[model samples]
Target chain A: MLSLDHARTILDVVLKTGTEKGFKPLAAVVLDARGAMKAFAAQDGTSLKRGEIARGKADGALAMGLGSRAIAKMAAERPAFVAAATHAVGGSLVPVPGGVLILQGGEVVGAVGVSGDLSDNDEICAVAGIEAAGLKADTGA
Target chain B: MLSLDHARTILDVVLKTGTEKGFKPLAAVVLDARGAMKAFAAQDGTSLKRGEIARGKADGALAMGLGSRAIAKMAAERPAFVAAATHAVGGSLVPVPGGVLILQGGEVVGAVGVSGDLSDNDEICAVAGIEAAGLKADTGA
Candidate 1:
C-alpha cells in the first residue's frame, strides 16, 4: 500500500511538470492502494468538465490496473470491454490520456491520473509524476 | 483563488470530526475559488453510492453559490429556477447535504459538499469542515 506521502509526492511533481511544460492541466487525482482518492488538485483555468474527465480516467486506470493510454489501445482492439465497462459503471469509466497507473515492484500499487491538457500531454504529466517520484511507471505492455 | 491547501485542510478537519464522532461518511469534496474540485476524499467504509450524491451537492453549491440545503429549500419555494438549473446541468444539479458554499470575508470563494451518513450528518460535515478551517459557513438567508 503506497502511503499518502507517495501520492502527494507524485502530484507535486506532476504539477511542476505541467508548469514547466506549459500544460494547463485541470485536475490530478491520486488514489491509494484501495483505489480511493488520497489527494486531488485542480489548476486554475481548468474547466469543470476537465475535472470530471480526469476523475473518470483515473478511476478507469485504477480499476483496470493499466495506464489509460493502454486501455485506449485495448479498447480500440476490443470495443466490447469498453462498452461493458461503460455500462457497468453507469458512464463513469473512461479510457483516456489522463489515467496512469503507479507500479511498485512490477505490481500496481496505485494510480495518478490528470486532465485538462491534451491527451498526450496528460499522459506525459502522469508519467513524469511517477518518474519524478522514483516510483515505477506502468507504461503498459 | 482558494488553494488546494485550504481545500485539503477542510477535508482533513471533516474526516477527523467524522472519525471522532463516529460518522460513517461516504465522501467529501472541496471546490476552489473557481468552483472546481480542489480536493476529494472518501472514507474507507463509505459506500460508493454516496460518492455521486456528495459530488452532486458540491456541484450544486458551486454552480448556485448557495448551500445544497438552501438549494433544496429554494427548489421547493421556486421550482422554476431549480428546474431550469437542473436541466441546464443535465441532471447534475442535485440539492442535498454534502455541499456548502465556502465563504471568506463574507464573499463566496468556494464550496464543500459531502454525501454519506444521514442527510443531517452530511450537512454537518460540510459546515464542520468550513468552521474547522476558520472560515464562515453560509446558513443561507
Candidate 2:
C-alpha cells in the first residue's frame, strides 16, 4: 500500500518542479494502487477546472493500467471508442498526456497526474515527481 | 480558499485519528468551496463504495451549505423533498452524518466527509480531521 507521506512527496515534488521550470500554475493528484486519491494540490493561480482534469487523467491511467500518454494515442486512433468509454464510465476517463503510473520494485503502486500546463509539460512534471519520490514512472504501456 | 495542501492535511489527520481510535478503515473526501474534490483516500481495507458515499455526503453538505447531520435530520423529516432533491442532483446528495463543513475565519471554505464505519463514527472522524487542520466544523444549520 502506498503511504500518504509518499503521496505527499510526489505532489510536493511535482509542484516544486513546475515552479522551478516556470511553467504555468498546475494541479496534481496522486492515487494509490486501487485508483483512489491519496493526495492532491492545485497551485494558487490554477483554475478550478484543473483539479477535475488532473483526476480524470490519473483515473484513466489507473483504469487502463497504462500511462495516459498511451491512452491519448489510442484515443487519437479510435475517437469513437474513447468517447464511448468515457461516457460509459461517467466521464472519469480522460485521454491525456499528464498521467504516469508509479512503479516500485517493478510493480505498479499508484499514479500521479498533473494539469494546468501544456499536456507535454504536465507529463514531464509528473515523471519528475515520481522519480523524485524514488519510484519509476511507467510512461510506456 | 482551501489549498491542496490543506485538503491533504485534513485527510491525513482523519485517517490517523481513525487508526488511533481503532475504527474501521475509512474513505474520506475533501472538497473545495466550489465543490470540486481536492483530495480523497480509501484506507487499505475500505470498500470501494465508501469513497462514493463519502463524496456524496460531502457534496450534499456543500450544496446545502450545511452539515450532513442537519441534512439527515431534514431528510428524516421530509422524505419526499429529500428524495426529489437527490434525484434532481443526479444522486450526488446523501443525507448522512459523515459530512461536515470546514470553516476558516467564520467562513465556509470547504467540507470533509468520511465513510466505512457507522455514520456517527464517520462524522466524528471528519470533525476531528477538520479540527486538526485548524478549522471549525459547522455541523449545525
Candidate 3:
C-alpha cells in the first residue's frame, strides 16, 4: 500500500524542491496505484488549470502503465494513438514529462506529478521529490 | 480569500462530520474560485473514483455559477443542455447536491464537495464543514 504518509511526504518535498530550485509555482498530485488521489496541493499562485494538467500527467502515466515521459515520446510518435488513449481514459491523459511512477521493489505503488515550469524542469523536481521520499522514480528512461 | 487554511479546515471537518454522523468513508475536495483544487482528501477505504466525483461536484458548481443543488434541478429539467454543458466544461461537471458554493459576504470565493453516503447526506456534511470554517454554504435553494 502506498500510505498517505508517503503521499504527504511526496507532496511536501515536491513543493519544497521546486521552491529551492527557483522553479515557478507548482501544483503537485500523488496518486495511489489504484489512481485515487492520496494527496494534492497547489502553490498559492498556480494557474487555475495547472492542477488539472498535473493530474493529467499522473493519470496518463497510470492509464498507460508507463511514465509520462514515455507517454510523451509515444505522443510525439503516434499522435493519433495517444489521442485515442486520452479519450479512452476519460480525458485525464496529458502526454508530457513531470509524471513519474513510484516504484517499491520493482512494483509501482503510486505516482507523482508536478506542473508549473518547463516540462523538463518539472520532471526534475518530481524525480527529486520522489527520491527524497525514499522511493524510486521511474521516468521511463 | 479562501486560503489554504480554510480549505484544510473544510476538508478536515467534512471528514470528521461524516464520521461523527456515521456516514460511510468520505472523499472531499475544496476548490478555489478559479477551479483550482486548494485541498483534497479521501478516507483510506474510499472507492478509487470518489475523488473524481468529489471534484466533479465542486467543478460543476463553478462551471454554472450555481450550487450543485441548483444544477441538479437544471439537469433534471434540461437533460440535453446539462449534457452539453458537462462536455463543454471538459467533462468535469457532476450535477448533484453534494456540491455547494462557499460564500463570504454574498460573494462566491470557492466550493466544498463531499461524497460517500447518500447525495443529500454528502451535501449536509459539506455544508457543515463550510459553516464550521466560518464561511457560508450556498446550496442554491
Best of the candidates, TM-score: 2
What are the per-model DockQ values?
A: 0.35, 0.45, 0.57
Task: Name the regions of candidate 3 deviating beyond 4 angstroms.
Answer: A73-91, B71-93
Best by the DockQ measure: 3
Model 2 agreement with the true structure over A3-109: per-residue lDDT tens digits: 76688788889999999999999989898898777767777667768888998999888888989999999999999998998887778887989989999998889
Interface RMSD (Å), every candidate: 3.2, 2.6, 1.3
Better of 2 and 3 by TM-score: 2
Ranking by DockQ: 3, 2, 1
Docking class of 3: medium
Q: Please provide, for model 1 over B1-141, each residue's C-alpha lDDT reduced to its tens digit, 9 standing for 90 to 100.
A: 666667777888877777787887557888776656788777765653555577788778778887888888888899998989988986767776557888888788888878777777777777888887888877343
Candidate 2: regions farther than 4 A off: none
In terms of lDDT, the poorest run of 10 residues in model 1 chain A is A1-10
User: What is the per-residue lDDT of model 3 for residues B35-126, given as tens digits with 9 covering 90 to 100?
Assistant: 87998877778897998898899999988999999999999999999999999989999898999999999889999888888999999999
Please give the TM-score that candidate 3 achieves against the real structure: 0.82
In order, the Cα lDDT scores of the candidates are 0.77, 0.86, 0.89
Q: Is candidate 1 or candidate 3 better by lDDT?
A: 3
Distance from true position, residue A86, model 3, in Å?
A: 4.9
Residue B9 of model 3, lDDT score: 79
Clashes of 2: 0
